[model samples]
Target: MSKYTSFPEPGDDHNPFQDPAVTQHSSNTEYATLDLYNPFDNKNGPPPPAYAATAPSAPQPVVPATTPPSRTTPTEPRNYGTSFTPQTAVNATTAELLRKQEELEKKARELERRERELDSHALGPGATRQNNWPPLPTFCPVGPCFYQDINMEISQSFQHTVSIMYYYWMFTACTLAFNLISCLSLFCVEPSGGVGLGLAILWVLLFTPCSFVCWYRPVYKAFRSDSSFNFFAFFFIFFVQVIFYVIMTIGIPGWGFSGWIVSLAALKTSVPVGVIMMLNAILFTAQAAMGVVLLKRVHSLYRQTGASFVKAQAEFATGVMSNQAVRQAAANATASAAQGAFTGAAR
Candidate 1:
C-alpha cells in the first residue's frame, strides 16, 4: 500500500455482482434514477433496463397556457341589431351573405319610401331636388354625356342669347317707335306738316332697317351660343342707344331737326307709337331684372352641388332644405330597419 501497488487486475471472467468486495464503491457513484411504473417513464415504450428508477413522475406539457382570452368567457350573450354586424374571423362567406341581405333590405325600404312619397304631393320626379338631382354630364367614369356640350355650346349660347336679347330689346323699341311715327305722320291732317312726313319716311328707310341689322341678328346668335358671343356687339348697340336716348331727351332737340331723319314725326300718331314705346321699355326692363335673379338662383345651386362656376348652372336652387330632408328620411328608415331586426332577433 505504501508503494501504491495494485492487486491482481480484476478478472475479466469474474462478474462484479458475484465478486462484491472489489466493487464496494458502486452505491456512492453517480447514476440515473427512473421509475418503471411511471407512465411518462415509458418514453414511447419503457426506459432501458439499466436506467430505470423508483421516484414519482413530473407534470405534463399537453395543457395550454394558464392565462388566455377564453379565461373570461362571458356567461351572458352579447346582442347587437342586424345593422351592427360583427364579423368573425371564421366564416367569411356567411359574413358576406349577411352584408348582401342588409343591402337588399335597405334597397327595398328605400323603394317603398319612394312609392309613398310619390303618392303624396311630390311635384317633379323626386321633387324638392333630392333623388332627382341630375348628375352633371361628363366624359369619364361617372357619366356618358360629354360635359363639352354644356361647356362649349350651351354656356356660350346662353351668354350670346343674353347679349343678343339686350340689343334686340333696345333695337326693337327704337325701331318700333320710329316706324310707328312714320306711318302715323302719313295720316296727319296738316297735309304737309310735310316736314313731319319727310322725317317719317327717312326713319322707315334708315333707322328701322339699320337697327334691325345691328340688333336682331346678334340676338339670334346669342340664343344659339348663350355665352358672351360678342361683348363689343353689346357695347356697340348699347352705346348707340345711349346716344339716341341722350339726343332724344325731353328737350326734343331732334324734333326741330330737318325731316324724319331728326323729327318726332313718329309722334304724329299718338296712340300706337305711345303704346309701342311703353311696352318695349317695359319688356327690356323686365328682362334685365329677370336675368339677374335667375343667375343668382343658378349660382346658389352650383355651391350646393360642389360644381364649379365655370362648369354650368343647370341644377335647381333648392338644397339646404332638400338635403336635410333626405338625410332625415334615410336615418329614420335605417333606424326602423335596425329596430325591426333586433326585435326579430330577440324573439
Candidate 2:
C-alpha cells in the first residue's frame, strides 16, 4: 500500500448505511404510507402521475356560477274595490279634475247666453225701434215722436207703478183742459179777465210737454235702466211739479188757475157757472192729492232700489264724458276759447 492511499474498514460491504436495497425499501414504504394517510387526496381519480410527486399541480382558477335573486309572492289575497294603491289614487284625482273643468265650461256658456239676452232687451245691433207713442192715426200728417211700451220696456216689478204714473199724466192733461174751459168762461163773464184765458192756454201748452219731458220721462228711464242720475232728476223735477200743483189747487183768481177762490168769486155772479168752477176746483184738488201720493210711492221705490246722491253725481259725470255729441261740443268750445285768447293777446 502506498503512503497516500486509504485502507477499507472491516465489514464495509455489508453495512446498512451503505446498502442500496435497504435505502430503496425505506423510501417506498414512506411513499405508500403518505399516499394512504393524505387528507387532500382524490381516491376516485387516477393516481397522481409519476412526475406529480416532484412538483406541485398548478392551482385551477375557480369560476363561480351566477344566480338571480328570488322574488317572493304575496301570501294573502286582496279585494279589487277596497284595495288602495298609488296608481289608483292618481287616476281618481285626474278624473275629478276633468269633471270640474267641464262644469266650469258649462257655467261660462250660460253666462254668455245671459249677456246676449240682456243686450237684445235694448236696441241691439241692426234692430229697429218704431215710433209708437201718442198712437197717432196713419192718415194724420203728424206722426208719433217717441217709442214707449211699459210692458216691453219696463221690468215686471215696476210695471204697475209706471202704469199708475201714466194714468196720472193723462189726468193732468184732462185737468188742464178743464181749467182752460173754466178760464174762458170766467173771461166771458168779465172782459178784463181775457188775460186769464190767454195765460191758461199758455199753461196747457207749456206744462203738458214740460211735465212729460222733465219728470215723467226721467222716471221712465230711471225705472227702465236703473239709472241713478235719472232717478235724481225725476225726484228734483217731480218735487217742483208737485209744489206747482199744490199752488194751483189753492185757486188764485187772476193767475188763470181754476182754484177755490176763483170758483167762490164766480158764485156771486151766476149759480151754474159757480157750480162749474167748483167742479173744476175739486178736480184741481184731486190732481194735487194724486201727485203727492205718486211722489211718496216713487220715493219709496227709489229707496228700495238703493239710489244715492253720490251715485247720481258719478253717473252724470260718466254719461256726459261718454256722450259723443257732448264731447264734440266740448272740444269745439275749448278750441274757440283758445283761439279767442290768442287773438286777444296778439291785439
lDDT of each candidate versus the true structure: 0.46, 0.84
What would the per-residue lDDT of candidate 2 be over residues 65-111, giving only the tens digit for each residue?
87886758666656667877788899999999999999999788666
Number of the top lDDT candidate: 2
Worst 10 residues of 2 by lDDT: 30-39
Model 1 score (lDDT): 0.46
Q: Write the residue-wise lDDT of candidate 1 on 74-182 in tens digits.
A: 7755656533234553467788889999999978866665565465455655754232212444554554221121222233325444454445455545544644454
Q: For residue 7, what is the lDDT in candidate 2?
A: 40
Model 2 deviation from native, Cα RMSD in Å: 23.2
Clashes counted in candidate 1 amount to 21
User: Which candidate leads in TM-score?
Assistant: 2
Model 2 accuracy (lDDT, Cα): 0.84
Give me candidate 1's TM-score against the actual structure.
0.26
Q: Which ranges of candidate 1 are over 4 A from the true structure?
A: 1-187, 219-229, 249-347
